[model samples]
Target: MKINIPETDQERIVIVGGGFGGLTLARKLAKSNYQIVLIDRNNFHQFQPLFYQVAMAGLEPSSILFPLRKTFHRYDNVYIRVAEVTGIKLAEKRLETSLGICNFDHLIIATGADTNFFGNQQIADKAIPMKSVSEALFLRNTILNDYEIALSTTDFDDRQGYIDIVIVGGGPTGVEVAGALAEMRKNVLPKDYPELDCSEIDIYLVQSSPQLLKGMSEAASEKALEFLTELGVKVILNNRVVSYDGEFVEMKDGSRIQSRKVIWAAGITGSLIPGLPEGSVTYGNRLKVNRYNEVEGVDNVYALGDIAYMEEEEYPQGHPQVAQVAIQQAKQLADNFKKRAAGKEMKEFSYRDLGSMATIGRRLAVVDLPNWKFQGTFAWFVWLFVHLFAILGSRNKLVVFINWVWNYLFYDQSLRLIIRTGAPWKKMDDVIDEGERG
Candidate 1:
């Protein structure tokens, strides 16, 4: 059966994944003469930068996700569907989705990336990854459930194990999560669970590299380390996590950290679609695209966001899988489409380096802008403003800003209620496995 999109004489552009790239492109081409069909597993566009906050209970999930249909409300030519693209029929210009078949004159793959377990099935099966709203909610539930279990357990070691958290990777996500957990250990936990020894709640950040924030400025990295360290996070540098078994995290250096929760912020691999040319799949499972973001060896099939691997003279490898890169590429692609319709020359895409930022705790952050790098209070505010301003909807912005202020003033988060259907104190796979068996 075919998806029930209305038949239009104008060319149809099927965009798989309503992420940063796909959503941006659809909005950019709203006034164009083409019919746009946007598809995603979820109905909303998730603001990824705040996913760690959601996992750490610093922000609610709704504060970060905006409905795709709501976003394209006035755009009559745009259609939104909540469907997973299963396969691509390049010759037929059609997509096999969970709902039905979808035919398109042009296709844009912005499926983004998934957690990279690095070929370790054990780690992949056990470790929790904070990539989307549901995952973040799962992590939050797991953490809170662990503490509740800790309160009932008499054994000191087991209780410590229950509350302890080992976060792999010292990238922005890891650092932010560790910092938030440390803040909770200091402020919220003590007040909420007065009986438990909150001091025993350890937050470990393990990184394989010598420094955190590897791509950012050295000064920013140093400041981040300082901030996290001051927040009482045990930052382990130059060490790699080999495996996790939902009980203990084994490191490469023959050491093990006992923890009930393991957050996998180590890496991400592109979400590759089946039926694409095997040669087109490159390192990190990304699709090889040219300067114009067109997938090589495929006509009318393009890639954007984390899925596209484009190499330039300056960047021997692909450009960093950042939102700016995706947004810029989408803008360029949108312009190129218009240029094609206007019979004008299409321009090539070139990435302009806009620096990076990471916040460790309240009033502690590091920002590396193109011209300047800063840290501490100023950088923290800058980080807040940038992220707040970048959020999609005005209502979302206001809600998030109010939440931030409330958190800052109260030294507590309001959205800590563990709301789940059932399956208390269970890992992600265990829940899935139980469902499958039942």
Candidate 2:
């Protein structure tokens, strides 16, 4: 059985993963040229950079998400489906999805990336990963509930375990989460949970590398470490989280950090699908594509975003798996497709990076632009502006802007309610009902 898409004379372009890249490409494409089918497991486009904020109780998931169907409401030719694409039947240009087979003349793989546990099943089973809306919600619930559990637990060790947090990875996500949690512990938690001693809640950021934010500049890294320290986040460098059997986080050197809540933001590998030629898959499970983003061995198949590994003049291995690169590539690909339809030569994709920035806490951020590198209050506002501007809708931008302003004026985040109860692994309805009852 097929996916039940209506037959159209126009060449169909089936794009996988409704991420930044796929969303941009679908919006940019002309409705008349191709029948666009965008398929993703979720029916919403998540602003992934802000998932940390959701986990930290600073923002609601819906505020950073845009409905996939609403994204192309005006375009009649664009069809969006919420389906998990299993693999590809390349022989007939067919996609094997959970629903059924989906045929396409051109296929775009934009499935993005997944959290990298590095073959640690123990850690994977116990740790929380902030990759999606649901995952973020689970984390928010788990973190808030941990404190509640701490307040009543008779055993001191178990109480400490409920309050303490071990954040793996010192990258942007890890740093941001650590900073946010520190902020909460300092400003939000004490007032909310007066019964418990919030001051004893230790937050540790663990990184195998010697420095935090390894991809950033030395100055930024140094400032981040200092900032995190000042905010009461114990930074543990040159140590790897070897295991976490639900109670303590074990280091490579045999030392153990006692914490039940472990946040895994250390690394990411590509969310690659099967059926592509072996040569096309590269390091991090990224797909090997030409400058045009066409798969090396697959005819009329292209990949984009975090999943597309194009080794260009500027990017030898591949472009950094960031939203900016994805957006730029999607626009270029759309332009190439439109030009091809107009009987003009297709243009090769080139990424124009705007730079990178990370927010540590209130009035604390680092920005590295092409010719400028700054930190502190000024950089914080820059980081806020860039993210606010990048958000999809005007209402969302307004909501986020007001929230940030309020947060800056008064050191608080009001969205800290744990409206989802029960263990993170429990049923959704049960969690919601428990929260309501509590």
Best-matching candidate per lDDT:
1
Task: Compose the digit string of candidate 2's lDDT tens values, residues 186-282.
Answer: 9899999999888899999999999988878888899999899999999999999999988888899999988878999999999988889999999
TM-score of each: 0.96, 0.95
lDDT against the true structure, each candidate = 0.90, 0.88
Write model 1 residue lDDT over 1-438, tens digit each, in one string. 999999889899999988899999999988899999999999999999999888778888898999999977788999989998899988998999999999999999999999999999999888888888888888887788778878999998898888889999998989989988988888889988999988888889999999999989999889989989998899999989988887889999999999877889999999988989998999999999999999989899999989999999988899999999999999999999999989999999999988889998989999999999999999999999999999989988999999999999999988887777466577645864553110
Best by TM-score: 1
Q: Give the TM-score of candidate 2.
A: 0.95
Clash pairs, model 1 backbone? none
Relative to the unseen true structure, what is the Cα RMSD of model 2? 2.7
The C-alpha stretches of model 2 lying farther than 4 A from their native spots are 421-438
